[model samples]
Target: MPLFGRKKSEDPSALRWSREPLPPTPEPGPDGLRSMEDHRDYLLSCLTELPPFSQHLLDALDLSICEDVYSAIDMPRFDNSAMDGYAVRAVDVAAASAEHPVSLPVVGEVAAGQDALDRLSPGTAIKIMTGAPLPPAADAIVPYENTDRGASDVRVFAPSVVSQHVRYVGEDIRAGSQLFAAGAQLGPRDVGLLAAIGRDTVLVRPRPRVAVVSTGSELVEPGQELGHAHQIYDSNSTMLAAAAKAAGAQVYRVGLVSDDPESVLQVISDQLVRADLILSTGGVSQGDYDVVKAVLPQLGETDFTAVAMQPGKPQGFGLIGDDRVPMIMLPGNPVSAFVSFEAFVRPAIRKLMGVTPYTRPVVRCRATHDFGSAPGKRQLARGIVSLDADGGRLVELAGGHGSHLLGDLARANAIIVLGEDVTQVATGDDVDVWLLDEVS
Candidate 1:
């Protein structure tokens, strides 16, 4: 009803104007706080892209056999002697001992790596060296320590058993048996096994190529003189390269690029052509100088932005070029850069490198002090892990929680993960930790 009004029924249609639809809410990406489990699941689903490679034998790769495999060929290849003494019939030395010695004429001498020429007869013995082929007529080998050697005869003081010290053909390995199964990572002992079985070449998965770059004009090369005003030496490229290599990837450091759109686009284009994965640190935040955030959409569609994690909260992910090589953009701060790499980027690289079950080992520990984290985001706090009184592992926070503190990261052996919904934890509270180093 028009209270100030004049004509209520004259223009009823004019009063019934349609309301415009509100703009659609923006689709969710990696922004907003997320649970640890939710983040882990997202990462697992997204890291399905892996390089294709064939597996090979350990022997071919000069690796060891920590596991047992059935022999494919007869071991010992041939029947041979196992001692450097007299080879005689067991019947001849049945009663021979120190108290009652049996004497026999030596018919011939068989040295190692040589064939036995003469067969032993009754009342006769043949001198045999270790690894020499056993004479057909000899059934046992008596050690030299138990025999008295003479010009043509030897006296045995110890009784000899049948087939004693004789290595039979095929005793170690049988022909046509499976040696090793597929998918076993070759080791030194595996290498010996392959050699023993006569393998020359092995096929292995090709190493994944990872390209790393540092961003920001304020960052200079390590050897270069530092500028007095807000300039720092670049370390993210070197650190990321080393970490990639240690994770079995072939690393390529593209060095530092200024926080400029054209420069970043050119570097990313070049890297995407050669790298299976590209990692760049800096220029991901909302700062005026954040070039990566500005440039990524120009290069390719953004997969996500700003994961719900600390230190690395401003992370970004997307394809690099038309070829669609995966690229991950990390924050510039040293500790943030490293923590992001460990929590997400490392697993992705490992997957591309054909690493199975590509996830870090998580252990339970008791926090030494109370800890606090923002609600709805996962917090990875650096900590030192050690064995407690009951032999259980314990993790204590490493100094400061600031993202720029690289010193704390250096001394940290593990990362204490606080999940979303857990805002505060008391001392001795159970926490989940991922061990950074592989300790026995």
Candidate 2:
């Protein structure tokens, strides 16, 4: 019989001995707080190398090539005119000037896109348009203003220099050379360059697929009425999707899940099959209804929990399901979720997406207020950045530092990072800040 069914006399210590001691709680490292550096280092360690996949050339990819040199073939590809005037040999207008003008026969006209059949004779000129390839015999182009044109002849009042206003072959790009190098993100100019080189496709890194899930029964989708109590609008999914897209990932908004272990497990199980990375918000904390923390162990092992950061302290990371897709669990608070994503999730996504290291540009600036924090934890404060009197950058803290203050987050353009062991910082104190906006 089982110990619970057996009589106490049969096995007094059986019940007590059968019970297992609670697993020892993980001790927080260094002052009982995990610093930002610790969180970063831990995340970097968990990333596994992903297999390469073939993607279409036209796909919206963030290219990793930085330099590319393209060659030009028959640059201009033909002899054309360069000015909206006339093409002639320099010797033809050698002695022509305002005081002693020279007149010659303009036997034919050549516009850009049209070829000139009549070649220039020794003393003749041809009317040409801007961008028209220079004729083979022409060595200079005189502006229309410097010449007077008749029905079949033209008069020149200003002498032109050799090769003046003429676009030479292979001047812009030679026939053969290295086009774009590795690590360059193709943009409009790159597209034009590729087109110029007669290339319709290019090799690029495939975008990483990211699945976003927002957890919480209290979260109500927009356009739906929220119950009178304990209900909040679902913003994490949209926000995370947009952020992931901006970070060059193909975002699959997986919608919201209730705070139920079964539902959370189902969502992760479904997403793990398709996503390279799974990002979920809420349920990682040790709350009574925190289903994620419970389900994570059942589905996969937790990588780490409870990063030592304010507003985003309840965070977790782990693999999901048998597919082993990396998953990040962020807190339910809107600001907390956003901050956690930026601090931990974004870097991993960037790394997998082929973004260069040190992509987030940091700047040293002065704090405009006396911001204070606990000595043991790292704090990321939202602030507005501006240039100081001496042209140095300064960050001003936004009001309302609470984790749930979405309005403050909306107004913030920078994040002031206070490292561990630092308690208080007075105004004008030098600080390290990540600029959220372009500083002119």
Candidate 3:
């Protein structure tokens, strides 16, 4: 069944869908709920990549460039010595050897950064240091090791080859050539290159700022003493914030907000100043305490829908606040929240950062053992994925398939994704998996 309906939301900075009548939603499954694929697509469609900004080279690391960068100056601006050597005429040293060494008057000494070019007279050599500019008429270099370490007169014991140890202008890269193409993310080496090319700044897309909020009446801080038996520490905010950071977004970890409509509204509204995207966990399902679902619709056009997925069925999303920042509501269970992130939030964050292929890389693997899945719902089972003896993919469930199993989710490094129709998988059967380690 189609999970995404026609996009009616409008964002001034984003590419909006057409106002023309859209095709009808796809046919529904027996549960009559939207499919996971459709819901994820809807959230992504509503997002626009963040605008580009000018940032210094060091600050632009890991960010994608928005425009092509061309070299303004040639590398190796002038001919220089590749090593500490005596600049010489190759012919003058052609007969100089240890058995029959030639003697020459050392006219002068040149170190790196010295621009003086005293032309080399025949039968004469200039003592030069590494990276020193070559004299105007010099053609080769005789290393100091081949000549006596003398201050004035020197003895050459080896022959020099023309152009040897000489670094010519534009040897590496010429001026006005393309240094980096648009959309290339800067790495350590790229930063070095940018510096080498005299680029102090670059234009690139900035990382998205994500605000993570957790809502619950019984939630308490991790270190606080529990006021009641039913109270549990709020772990969702920290977990989600770390995940967002790992996904290359700046994260704001908000404190727990009780299940009150006014508090929820106030907290979410205040975050609009810094948040490019808002992610809240809990209170989207059908329950008496579903305050988020009831209060969010008042702030913006929000929807609470049932998705056909095990561990996480209730979902919510919309553009909220006056600035219209995108917000995605996730289930309260830790495992469900994580799976929801893998399916939706991570991709949205990727889209905001202007990266391609938002979804985690999926691979076809064989099951290490049999596992059961809920009928009429797609299941994301926590599991460990690795290569078999033959270098083929293999996966095994980390623990029992339970939504509240945080320990198993912690142990898992991958997700075993079973389609809605798959009820069981026997040993050695093929399976599809999302590699959690490859968020990029």
Candidate 4:
């Protein structure tokens, strides 16, 4: 059975299905609801089709390589001195000691980038600065402290070995060697490496451009006077924008819209020209004023489904516009929207940017407090995961499990996941933990 375009019922109390009989308690199962992994795979299947270009030199610092970066020249292209010392023939100072000192005439002085035309022979030395090219016929270096520290003539009291204090050519990196592989995230050091290799810019995957929208008639911008008694602050757009930015995507935040389908559709249409992904929070539930549901399906192949998950069960996803940009619809509640982003949208953005292993780090830990979950529905409850004195991993609920509880979500470092069959979890029971703080 295809679960791709399953339409959810407008009323949960009187559930009805178009193709088959409704199950008890509106519990979506493996056959009815799309699994998290299946949905993620479907979203990632078309990401490779994103166009790549190397013509534009990346002006910003945060970028990732799309292919392996190879070196054009050998590192340390020439043999240079590693210390400020006298470049001399090792044989001249091989037998010199404190009691029987050897003297050598300093023929010339050389600093970094200076020509080393003077040749060093037996009983002669060149006063070489650090990073200076080695003079001809010089085999080793004698430090200034071991000699008289003189510029014209130097006396050596200690024996020196061949190739001492010398930096050989191609010692750090050889020409034609690969510096970094594909999918490697580039930082300042990586950029510097590319510069050292004589490349003005590198081929990198373009950052996924994300457009965030929040919908509701009973919402107003923060710091403004709330004239209506029912109006609350619109925070989902800003929060989702920040989250997308933190995941390495370029974010464009759309202004808040009312519960009108036409207005929401127009805003999404306007953003399709610039965005690679569109994320909207609010108005996708079983309510009459569900703006996202009413607008998204009219534009493209959007599917409004009831997933087997709590707080964010009413979800929607599809491709839209001529470019077929991916769009994710999250529930209206702030906590629910944030949780859905962490679980799905963030990873999708990373995947669009060619990042591998995009999912959050997961760990299994024993629950320190008792918690209850709805029957036959997966639950992702906020929790603070920590290690005890004995190195035992313990997980405790951050606060109440309500979808509107932002205080608990702020304090949570992890999302404790309970299975569909698990109705009640007692203390000491192990649960899978999705490490939210690791990525956010």
Best by TM-score: 2
User: What are the models' TM-scores?
Assistant: 0.76, 0.85, 0.84, 0.83
Each candidate: RMSD: 13.8, 9.3, 6.0, 7.2
- Which residue pairs overlap in candidate 3's backbone? none
The lDDT of each candidate is 0.74, 0.74, 0.85, 0.78
Best-fitting candidate, scored by lDDT: 3
Shift in Å, residue 258, candidate 2: 0.5
TM-score of 3: 0.84
Model 3 lDDT per residue over 1-440, tens place: 11112233233223332233222334556678999999888888778888898999888888878999999998888999997978989999899889999888899989998884678898888999999999978999989889886778889999989998999999998999998998887889999999999989999888898999999999999988999789999888899999999988988999899998888887877776678899999999999998989888766667678899888899998677555678999999999999999899999988887877789877988998887888889899998988867788788999998788899898888999999889889999989898876321
- Cα lDDT tens digits, model 2, 416-436, are 788867899998899878776
**Which ranges of candidate 4 are over 4 A from the true structure?**
1-31, 46-49, 55-62, 94-104, 143-148, 155-160, 365-375, 387-394, 422-430, 438-440
The TM-score of predicted model 1 comes to: 0.76
Error of 2 at 396 (Å): 0.6
In model 2, the runs with Cα more than 4 Å from the true position are: 1-28, 48-58, 65-82, 94-101, 115-118, 148-151, 388-391
* Regions of model 3 farther than 4 Å from truth: 1-30, 91-106, 141-160, 364-367, 387-394, 424-430, 438-440
- Residues 1-440 of candidate 4 have per-residue lDDT tens digits of 12123333233223222332112223345558755555555556644424445633444245567778789899888888998989999999999899988899888889999987567878899999999999988989898889888767888989889999988889999999999997787777877778887887777767788889999998898888897688898888998999999888888998698887777777777676677888999898889898789767655666677777776777878676544567888998998898888778877887777776778877898999888988666788998988878887889999998999988888998988888788888999999999766422
Better of 3 and 4 by lDDT: 3
Residues 104-210, candidate 1: write the lDDT tens digits. Answer: 99888888788777667887898888988888888899989899875498999998899899998888778777777644556676767666887644544456678
